[model samples]
Target: MRKHRRIIAAFLLTAVAVGAVNTPAAASPAIDRGALLAQHPLTTYESGAEVGSALTAAGFHTPSSRYGVSLHQLVYRTVDAHGRPTAASGLLVLPRTGDRHLRTVSFGHGTSVYRGDAPSVAPDDMFLSGPAITFASTGFAAVAPDYLGLGAGAGPHPWMDVPTETSASLDLLRAARTFVARQGRTLDREVYAAGFSQGASAALGLARALQGGADPWFRPAAVAPISGAYAMRRVEIPAVFTPEVTPKLGAAYMAYLLSSYDRLHDIYRDPRDVFAAGYTGMGELFDASHPGPEVIAGVPDSVGELLTPRGRELLLHPNARFAAALREADSVCEWQPAVPVRLYVSPGDEQAVTGNATACRSSFAARGARVPAVDVGVDRSFSGMVHEGAELLAVPRIAEWFSALAGSH
Candidate 1:
């Protein structure tokens, strides 16, 4: 197991080394969104057994891998939060099979404060890359977007902004389709969408876009999102002030959210307007350079301690543009999905409470979409956090569901 892990790590490091020296290509005037700008070979698993071993060593449940997988880091054109064209990066994993036509799955990744933690850049970080690799080794071409500003993309990540998340995901699909075509593989129109944490919301957003005909070619076949803060205004924001969530976790999330919103919506004229005296520099912590641990360390213990009195009031009873932004971000589940959808959650999740998923199901039901929020159960292991554990338990089941759906189609 150690040897298999070493092989994976070495190859990933080598890919980064190779990618570092390559100069980015000049932007084309007529280049469309999702246009492939650059591609770097990352790593390859020789067989299904090797793929399974690598994943097992990384702490994921042993999955059935039918084929070897090859991974590539793709720098593609995508729009940033401001609607201007920018270069964003993602991972494109392909199954080593004789088939020329491939079913596709797009996996939106969980939250990461640092850019280096992105899947395309850190394939060995199972939390980010595992699902994409799992889908690829199981015969689906997996596209994992690093999202705007989180990979090699050029801006501060827009945190929970769902529009950019959907756009980054949609454009990555377009880029992946083009990349696969160059290798003589044609992607099917049906895209199986899945994600975890912040990404779960992204997956739902992507599904809504695809179902609503945001893209001319691709349509969502099925969606399975795990432990997302889908109903931010109704469930997530309220939970942060309660004892249900840990103070550190809640503060960190609040800091990230406000800073990101401030960038996109001008939520505050300055950080001091929102943050408390000591924590006023909170916005600088989420600039896509600092590590998550650093951000957590920089903040006060609780959301109440971190925010000013006015700031706390704004979050509790948001008004004006802040209210509108939260409303927009929280609306991912408001539409009725035409495809089969499942919301995976753990009742013990300390960060994003399971109530978020419950709220999402209620919203979906109101829209006549009877989506099920499946409990993947809590991770009881000594070393596991419930939030991370839920994802570990959920990915394999989601992969199995996607495979069955792909086969049926």
Candidate 2:
């Protein structure tokens, strides 16, 4: 049992480490949810100069005053999967020199295993902060959600669960609007949504919700989801069963999704039912209490090796509940977008599988939605091109895309 445990943990950790390099997780202290249910700011960076100082201190370059930016950390009320009211945190960045009515861009972050990687706590974590900063520098309001259970929120992060991710992100955008107004600022009613990897799926979910009339107050201007995992069951799930996946990445994401889904859907009666003997007791590894690379070091290679026989069976052919979760998470691209939409893919992206974007584009085209798929030019293989290329190349471009749309509208 101990030997199996060692192997399972190591392999899972390795899978996560590989994926973590491409996307991103963390642990956090407990907080009182009751007091923070009203959706308010926990802290604020008073001026662009103050933000600049903080950025400089954090080893980030301070941009010129094209549009000076300020930051705020918010704790807002949202619902869990069951519609139970819960608290989540996020960062709201506003441009100081914008026309009183600032255009908004909701930037969803990629997969992060650390709580500190959240924009509210560590905006510099995902290369995401740079884009948020860019949005602000370009005179846009950037709302970056910490998502539930991360940052100052209590309990486990929901990982890639679509409903929670959508709700958390939308609620943050709502909270940001209120936060802005309370401070004598105005926001343009429309929002440009964008993200990468897990975040890309999240952004699309928000766009779907907004287009579906979940929130009429905020119209969709444009959406850019770069290298999102839209077709998990089709592309990602099958790939994990083969060596095409890195053991570290498979372990990391599986542990994250399974553990998170267990919270929302009660998929596991006991951790031992799904996990190998070695990893049954280590549920805290993905609870945001630890970094992903450290967690990956402890997991073995391959999701199949990390799962029990029954667990492996479920992975290959999911039951109703499991299938439902995947279906829901993967349904981001199914809905039509009323606004302009661009699906960014990388030819080199192994983590997100470019096919997901292509399939998504096809869905949009079939539905007569104004959607176009762009392949960003990253041709490297697994280690370099597939994972980090989108973050390094696509994010800044996404900001520019958002800027153009915002300027036009």
Candidate 3:
């Protein structure tokens, strides 16, 4: 395996308050929130065995022996028997101690071609070896789960499924709390779910679901979903192709929805067949099934249809109908906390639905969320740069945000 340099993303809070406004909310103490753990690596091969061990060796194991560090790392299990969606099972990681009931952070990951893993990587198990331990080093317990198939070796990761990922997010958080409590440690039930790319979409969906209805378990103090795919239902996949930002983002999306909806599979027959012998089967079938962007990045037009039959099946399925109805019936962004929410975005992110932050702010405002957002370019040299650091930067701002609201976490 080639060694790729890991970008050690160190993001701390900036701007006590905009306009140099010295409000009480901007005057909170600086908390040592850890590093950022959001990025989709470009890989041609992935094996759970390899990734898992890497995480283990990184000191991501649960119930650890290290001091000033209480860590637990293990693969959580969940069964998706019925037509239900994935559960964020597999490879859970967290820090060992927080005398002051630790605040938990659940990360939503980006695209992986295969469905068996929800935004999963290979055998290296870098969640612990890479970011989870880094997070622990920063004094925060982290819960990172394989959305469904990947770690457990299940087939197909259910990308962008709301209920499944949402529960996974909250359940992981709940599980972490329970794990600590069982070990005679305590954790602040208050948590925040954050993600980037599709994982960001997952985080957004989970946040909405948890808060949109009568949640049995009280939700976190706030939601900080960045670079999310909140508006996937109406994106123009046909308009994407190549190095242009449009196609770069559209490639995996094309493969993902196509992989899920069998009906649409044939519509995107590999155009290469014309030259490859007048075609016998799809060129895609010849490629590996991992959901990496590279595999899908350079495919031909036959693979890039706008209206696919499989999409029709997904659109017409009973659950699909239920989704439409639920969306129409509720029609609101459900924020779990009665407190405030902080939406973050980069203006130059061509991968995102344009004006997403604006639309979100407008829509969420009517729903009663105190959202203080910063609309910046995609080039944030500091920690709050990308779509994943919503809460990362907010931790410092939390003491600031909560201090003003007199909130408790």
Q: Which candidate has the highest lDDT of all?
A: 1
Stronger candidate by TM-score (2 vs 3):
2
lDDT for position 22 in model 1:
32
List lDDT for all candidates, in order.
0.83, 0.69, 0.42
Candidate 2 lDDT over 1-409, as tens digits, reads: 0001111121122222212222111121332221233332323445656655654543333353255666667776666665655667777777767377888888888777766566776643435465576678667899888787766566678888888889888888877778778778887878899887888988999888887777768877889988888888888877766666665577767777788777777776788988998887447777766765677776667686678987777777887888899899888888767888888877746566677887788778778886878766773331344665665556656767777776675
Error of 1 at 185 (Å): 0.8
TM-score of 3: 0.60
**What would the TM-score be for candidate 1 when compared with the true structure?**
0.92
Alpha-carbon TM-score of each model against the true structure: 0.92, 0.82, 0.60
Please say which candidate is ahead in TM-score: 1 or 2: 1
* Candidate 2 local Cα displacement, residue 54, angstroms: 11
Please provide the root mean square deviation of candidate 3 (C-alpha atoms, Å): 14.5
Residue runs of model 1 more than 4 Å from their true location after superposition: 1-31, 380-383
lDDT ranking, best first: 1, 2, 3
lDDT of 3 by residue, 1-409 (tens): 0112122221101111111222233343331111111222222212333333443454333222231332343333232323232223333344433455666556665545443323233323342123333334345565665564433324455445555555555545555555656657666655566555555556566556656552465355555555555544433232233333344335445444444433222333334322233222223532334434344434433433432444333333324443453343223243434645666565555555545555556667766765656553344322222332332332333223323332342
